[model samples]
Target: MQTGISYCFLLGWLLCSCSETKSNHNQSIQDTAAVLLQQDSTSVFTTTALVEDTTVRFDMSEVPSEPDTKIKILEIGNFHNNEVWKGADNKQWYGLFQTTTGYYVKKTIVQVKTVYDALLDTKYVWSGKQVSVSDKDTCLLLITGISLPERNIDTVVMSQKTIWPSEKISFTVDSITYTLRATGKRQKISNEVSDYRLYISIIKDGVEKQQLLVVHDVFDDTMTVVMWVGDLDGDYKPDAIIDVSNHYNNHRPALFLSGEASEKEIMKKVAEFSQLGC
Candidate 1:
């Protein structure tokens, strides 16, 4: 027949060119598995939006307690290692940092655990270290949540308390007395023209509350002091941690919390952290 119909039309065009090259090699492996599943769902939606944009929370009725256990999570920073936190979950947490050098020393109780970061999924921090910290000698000041009758009050008040201006420093703690007074007016700063400010007042029971703290233009002795007082949010009352940094090579701590104070306010700074020395 014409050479067998040209060999069956060349074997039906070589079986339709091997079925269109095996359907383009299975559509290039399904378009490379749909671009690797859209890049693994955009890398898990950008690590769940970087763990919800660096969480910070802390407002569960501002620590009213006993709903599912308190401490709404604080975790400010400087504890190091990628710093991302939230899971205190089992409760009971606190770091505080800074182990020595001025304002009466002592505050290194860091064990830490609760990590699971596939990009910060669960966190609390610093575990497995049987205590041997040295960020060239520690500094961090917060991590939050601790109450239960505890009172190390940074070595239970060792020393450093010279906040004068009109002079009036006092402290009683558990029985509650805290008096503090340091009005202002101690100038120097050639041309920034200053009032400099300082304000303190505090009083309690008889109620006085003023609190401005410091403004500084610099010069003359420069030391705000008062470093530590008891009951940091356990709510037994009196809580403090001022450094105000009139400068001793700069420290600036500032943290007061009488359980978020407010009958009209006696103490309520909540938090502050700063440190620098070269």
Candidate 2:
């Protein structure tokens, strides 16, 4: 929870050169999984481990972590500079400074489980070292980690799919029923472009558990895709990472971890990464 550790990020944490750029609309489920590895003695990225293919076949259950890996980074989030000091509850964080000089300085990293069989989204909290980096320009950090899985888990992931209005898909996990539904309306926003509003939600036993997404006034041609589906927090309940971007010219993906949800909610959105296309 210190303010000086970005080393916890997976080997290749994608640093943005500029904000709001075009994003990959067709990214696969594997792209959402961040595999964090531990560096060996006296070096950076000097370790290697064996990993199995995780293309996510329908017959697959759980994805395997590389044997030599350290913490399996689920999702890293930014709470803006002002929100860094307060932090989120029941969550962990690894912080780093985005210095005025436009570079990163490594500080601290806490070791978690070496092997991860499940992927979960997380919230965060930064501890100290706010002044260690200089006057500062940006505040950033990572999220929760647990020692090891209590038991082996089966694969509960589904491939990415574009969901249209009136189109719903159902699947079973942990003996619980789940349905992904999409509903929306279209309106003209401009002479050349139309506006749209889409409501994406989860249904269980004739009840709507949560309104996962409600994209409003999105540009024409925008579509929502259920990027990946499964238990993102290993809570046995379903969690998701979804793309509710304006498909033709934008990419806005959000990560939801079931473990962070409130009692009445099925999942809580802990992180969202976005970009805009010209």
Worst 10 residues of 2 by lDDT: 121-130
Candidate 1: worst-modelled 10 consecutive residues by lDDT: 125-134
**Where is model 2 more than 4 Å wrong at Cα?**
1-160, 186-212
What is the TM-score (0 to 1) of candidate 2? 0.41
Model 1 spans > 4 angstroms off: 1-93, 96-181, 188-231, 252-276
* lDDT at residue 85 of model 2 (Cα atoms): 27
- List clash counts for every candidate, in order: 0, 5
lDDT of the candidates, in the order given: 0.51, 0.44
Q: Residue 21 lDDT in model 2?
A: 32
Which candidate should be chosen as best, given lDDT against the real structure?
A: 1
Whole-model lDDT, model 1: 0.51
Residue lDDT tens for model 1, 1-278: 99999999999999999999999999999999999999999999988774434543222222122223233223232222222223332344454444454322232344334323233233432221012222334433443444434334432453447555555656566665556665555435532222455554455577666666556665344557666666554556766677777656556677776677677666766655444332
Candidate 2: residue 10 Cα off by (Å): 99
